[model samples]
Target: MTEQHGSDTGPRYAARRRRGGIVSFVVGLVATLAFFAFFPGMPHVIDWGAVLASLAVGALARAGCRAWMAKEAEKEGKRIGHF
Candidate 1:
């Protein structure tokens, strides 16, 4: 029931890179700032919808990158990291 990977080093050496909380926080901060900076019109009260949407977009972008990397790795007979 074991899954086989193409590399001779095997899964043991196919270590996943860990993305820290700080990185995620920084990304979110930059994205939010950029959105507000370009779009303008920030309300006195926090706009939950805009905040959520920005975060969702960032998350989707990250997911898409990982998926693309995974696909590329598959083609190259290699495993992609989780991060």
Candidate 2:
């Protein structure tokens, strides 16, 4: 059996892996806003600071998850295909 190394992965692959956080951040922001928008008085009822904080938390979680997954894949000698 053969094992693949991280050196074989290109910058594009690294970028692809990192993109998860950015996507999650955008999705989180949109989702948060959407949730607030459902209310009749969104602007007055929603706390903007909390919404921003939630987006930040979501992005950080995504980054952590991506890193863990990459480490596990590397340990298993598995290739993470392009998204």
The digit string of per-residue lDDT tens for model 2 on 1-83 reads 64546664556556766776677767776776667767575564557685876677677767776777688767867677643
Off by over 4 Å in 1: 1-29, 40-46, 79-83
**Predicted structure with the largest TM-score when compared to the true one:** 2
lDDT of 1 by residue, 1-83 (tens): 64557553255434321242335545765687577656656554436776776677666655655566566677877745555
Structure candidate 2, residue pairs in collision: none
lDDT of each: 0.56, 0.67
